[model samples]
Target: MKELFPLKQVMGFAFSIFFTLLALAVYFFNMSFTIGMTVLLVTAFLQAGLQLVVFMHAGETEDKGAIYTNIYYALVIALVTVFGTLLCMIWGYV
Candidate 1:
């Protein structure tokens, strides 16, 4: 029974559920827009990391460092793209 128990996955699933509920609460509780967005963003990133590490087995491979490095690069690119767009289109930084 112990050998068959998927503890990590179960914990990850529970954490995911908790985060989902937290997001729902933040949405339905009529929180301020900025605070709500901040909470949601933080929870989203945490959930994403949990899913990647627990479900995706990100640390199981020999090239785990490369995998994490690539993920970081992707995140940087995404952030740059989003911020650049916001600056140019919304903030009128052209």
Candidate 2:
């Protein structure tokens, strides 16, 4: 069936490959470091999410909500720790 074929998944894979190639092009061509890094980061994050959701079916199980909640909490904590360090150390806000 078409579901088994998963055209959407194919498209997502193609897009991932395209973004990877684009990143390589930026690197090989010696483009602006800031721009290249930004693009690479964006694409890398997006591809990771796509792979998680599509291929891994991260939210398909009954515990998906719990999983996502845990992820969110972890992200919040990470952000706080990172920002706190930057604030205290770099910004001299202690």
Tell me the tens digit of each residue's lDDT in model 1 across 1-94.
9989999999999999999999988978999999999999999999999999999999899999999999999999999999999999999999
Q: What TM-score against the true fold does each predicted structure earn?
A: 0.95, 0.70
lDDT of 2 at 1: 82
Candidate 2 lDDT over residue span 1-94, tens digit each: 8668988778878987887887788878887889888988788778777787778887899999988888788879988999999999999999
Candidate 1 ranges beyond 4 A from true positions: none
- Model 2, poorest ten-residue lDDT window? 45-54
Query: For model 1, what is the C-alpha lDDT against the true structure?
Result: 0.95
lDDT of 2 at 26: 82
Worst 10 residues of 1 by lDDT: 19-28
For model 2 the local lDDT of residue 59 reads 88
lDDT of each: 0.95, 0.84
